[model samples]
Target: MNQLPTAPPVATAQVPPHLVDSTSRYVESGLRGAANTVRAYAGDWKRFNAWCTLNHLSALPASVEALAGFLTELADAGKKVATIQRHAAAITKAHELAGHDSPTADKKIKVLLKGIAREKKTRIKQAAAFTLATFKRTIQSMDVTTPTGLRNRALLLLGFTGAFRRSELEALNLEDLAFDEEGLIISLGKSKTNQLGQAEEKAIFYSPDSAVCPIRSLQAWLRVLGRTEGPIFVSLRKNQQLTARRMTTKYINLITQQYLGSGYTAHSLRASFVTVSKLNGADDSKVMNQTKHKTSAMIRRYTRLDNVRQHNSAKELGL
Candidate 1:
């Protein structure tokens, strides 16, 4: 009697054509989320397929045992729970699309997640609330005699005035800024104001004409630097000639480290700006526009006014 032959291993690229077409459509939706999300899911699925092939597991759709094995391997590799969960989600989505009800869908996923716990660590406090009253004095102490010093002073002024993220400050182009009769209109494509979750993409706008006079210093630096176009912040050599390239985020970090030490960050100016604005009674809508925040929740974190205002009121009443 002839023995039955073992089934050949399935090819990943042999996935149903309709599923591939649907995934393609999902990726090209033009939404910002679609691009990253679809790419991540597709990549995770490919990795899972490879793992299944190596383990000699039948990469059958919805196989809870195979999924459990995959999770075990991920844990052995020291993958974080969040990372494993993301991979599991992608696998489940793919399996469902292939018309195979995922055996690991709800039950096995819950069990796997239970094994992958969140890391426990102290959360670092934001540097915003620790406003040293001597920040201005520190700036005054900085030497402005040299070309590099002058540029550093200008950078400091812009950071405080514009509340720019280091990346946004680095990305600044000469064409993005306009010096008008009122003040400077900086076209900030990205900013600390945008935060991590804002949906709208409006650029942050900063004008030097505010009560702060240091905005003029930025203008002076711009004029003296002789940069009429291209990047607004250019690297300067020892000879004081402007380098064609722009400054980088790492350079900004270095400036912060050298000037303000450990507690200070590029984000400090942003927080300080928000605190100052709220203290001056600037409305949420105006602050929102300046910060380019789609919502008010993020701005609220920087405006810790309840206790500060109450303390001042008690002082006024001599209580």
Candidate 2:
């Protein structure tokens, strides 16, 4: 294969030092994947490397048998099927980086994964969807007079209305927001699906009740922030003074649980958005527009239609 200046040498069998050096730069520059994806692979690869060391097997250019053994043991030890799949993906990525054929490509390895998945069910418990009544009740319960209350109220409302992932919400800044006569416009810089850095916008409107309006809640929070730039949702110090540091995803989960009680994560905000919106007759295309989902399949996955009475076509059959 002809080698591009940016790619590793293929014809010479041995890559030149100069070509390898340039390739290394792109590898470290997140050209291969997202920052979080890279970090996850790095962590999974580290554990695999350690396992190989303990078993005296070469992690790089790993044998199919060795890789299979490592994965089978992890499954036996009760690692979820999703996690096991990630470990395999990490191994494949590491092999590709080292210019070696990945052992994970073997048919035996694929069959093994399938067998393990069949033996161990792949069902995942999703976040519970909170209804509009429950959502209104919860928001009203929050005392928004205090700075902390304002921040939390804005975080929850905006998060739900925008259908934002906690990671996306945590990275939000005041500069990303645009306020106008209509409502609020958010210039989302990058998202999990929007990795190529295309321009993306999410619009939210005013609610009849000022208390539940995401725009008004966000504006109230901004008034407390006293600054137009920098991180919007920030960490609060002991005395409730805002810190410049951005909030973490874990804290977002904790905050969601704190307000909504157990059985909900920060993901519930996004899930409920899909559930409630779909129940309210928003079509797949419209929901996909706000959710930034490229496919209807994923929108279906995010929807938590647990209620027997909600969204049932059986009831509408006029029996």
lDDT value for candidate 2? 0.86
The deviation in Å at residue 199 for candidate 1 is 14
Per-residue CA lDDT of candidate 2, range 73-163, in tens?
Answer: 9999999988999999988877776667899999999999999999997765678889989999999999987899999999999999999
Scored by TM-score, the top model is 2
User: CA shift at 148, candidate 1, in angstroms?
Assistant: 1.4
Model 2, residue 167: distance off in Å is 1.7
Q: Where is model 2 more than 4 Å wrong at Cα?
A: 1-31
lDDT of 1 by residue, 1-319 (tens): 0111122323439667558655544433322233235567777777888888888776556378888888778877877666777788777656544546665656756766675553422233465432434456667777877767777877876776566667777877777766655567775553443433334322333334432245565666677678677886778887877788788877886786677777777767667777777777788887776656557888887664445552265666765
TM-score of each: 0.59, 0.88
* Candidate 2 lowest-lDDT run of ten: 1-10
lDDT of all the models against the reference? 0.63, 0.86
